[model samples]
Target: MWQKVIIPFSVSFILIGCSEPEPLVEPSTVYQCAALTLTATVTDTGLDIQLPDQSYALVETISASGARYRDDDFAIEFWSKGNEATLIINGEPFPLCIEEGTLPTSFSARGNEPFWLASLTGQTLTMREPGSEQELTVEAPRLVEDEPIMTWSIAAEDGLNLMILDQYCQDSMSGQSYPYTAYLGREGEKEAGCAGDPRQLLEGVTWQLAQTASEQAPTIQFIPESNVAGFAGCNRYRGTYQLTGEGLQFNPLAATKMLCDETAMAVEDEWFRQLTEVQSFRLDAAGELDLVLADGNVIQLQRKN
Candidate 1:
């Protein structure tokens, strides 16, 4: 009887609840407005901005048209419509902020004096001049080392040949920098121009050590097809690289057998070690390439102009 009465006693219970996690923010967008470049990262409720001089965080605000963001102090404001944006600093508007477009993966070149354009897509190579355009099916370009410069030679039908140098060039009129200097040869005539694969920032441009101090700083140049060649203080090295979703990785590097003093060899050894340990790479606002290592150290490099 006592057991039956105790069984009628009240019981207590506890309840738990859970909420969904917020989604991650999308990748940042780079915008080139006139002479200024800006990188904007959209957050859950606001924007993280990176200017050449400084960085700013702004909250979303009401706008008549397009999206607008402003800081609490009203020191900076960003207004965007489609791919265009206007940046306001201290109430002074900087308009015409056009978004930077990605360049095509196909190789392209252009010259100004005589107005010529050439492009290689797949097996077809197209050449265009003032009033003439020609397309020819050609084989892939062959690498030819011309001493200090690396050149890619393309042989086409009808005795047409095109040579592209892995060197930096600037347009005479527009003053735009190109990764490669190109020469188009047909019959006995040749035309010189600037060529590039604009999508590849590390390609063609020579990069020199920016942070480390040395009389002969280490240098690197990324070639097409995942090949990389560099001067590592004492000897020249060549290796392959892979660009994955996570980061950049280099295969086992091979260097020329050249002996030098202890100082140079030491520098070379350190550089090779760093290159092997690189986990990722990024370009800073100042257009310097930063190679992040697994040990949380950074190897900075600048474009050799």
Candidate 2:
């Protein structure tokens, strides 16, 4: 009798030990989506979601693909896959929500017609025009009335001011879309423009002259840290380039003294002249780089394989 009782108790203990353990709760994660930014914390039984205006407690539900959470009381649903997510509220779906990149500390803006460029880094604002440039040390930009707009006021005699709005902007000339709209004002003059980092399009690619048919066409490579080196038909050239907003300028390039044939030297001379005249750059529909000259001409270049 004692043997039977001990066997039954041992079996009960084994069954209890084999029971499933509690689910582990994950740490909080921030998601920047297309429609909104939200923070989500996965709990053992549900998910805690925090939005800009409100918060919701969501429970895990069955999903065909990806993870799905729902809060019936709030009529909210969230589905996530990899770094992308979809949010649903009141039976409306907000799809194609992607994660955001790192925040930027510096910004650049440029306008057309008169053509001006401005870069803001820390407390220094650098303004550049065709033949002039000025740097101003000013206070930090202040947000305007809880809106996504920033304004910088300068105490200079010229009454220079800058305003940047968090809005989608398209370049007037290049047709490229930017993330910010910018306005620069000075003494009754205000210039409207687009703002973003333009260097991502130029860096990490070696471009060759597309307009030339010669076997030894001019090739240019833009390196990081404001350095540029390239072959200018007859000789190799090296220089530092300045890129601000939409503007691009090669500062006093120096070329090697190696002499080539008359044809090559002529090509080099023309290339250098065009480089000097370049005021801005745009990528054509075919993805070729077009260096826009001051006189409305374009020297096209193709990406080297």
Cα displacement (angstroms), candidate 1, residue 85, comes to 30
After aligning candidate 2 to the native by TM-score, how far in Å is the CA of 204 from where it should be?
A: 1.3
lDDT of 2 by residue, 117-177 (tens): 8787766779899999999775566555333444333333346777666565668976555
lDDT of 1 by residue, 25-79 (tens): 6789997653356899998869988976679999999999999999999899999
Index of the highest-lDDT prediction: 1
Model 1 TM-score on a 0 to 1 scale: 0.38
For all candidates in order, the CA lDDT equals 0.76, 0.73
- The TM-score of candidate 2 is 0.43
Worst 10 residues of 2 by lDDT: 148-157
Q: Which residue pairs does candidate 1 place in steric collision?
A: none
- Cα lDDT, model 2, residue 173: 79
Query: RMSD in angstroms, candidate 1?
Result: 18.5
Model 2, CA-based lDDT? 0.73
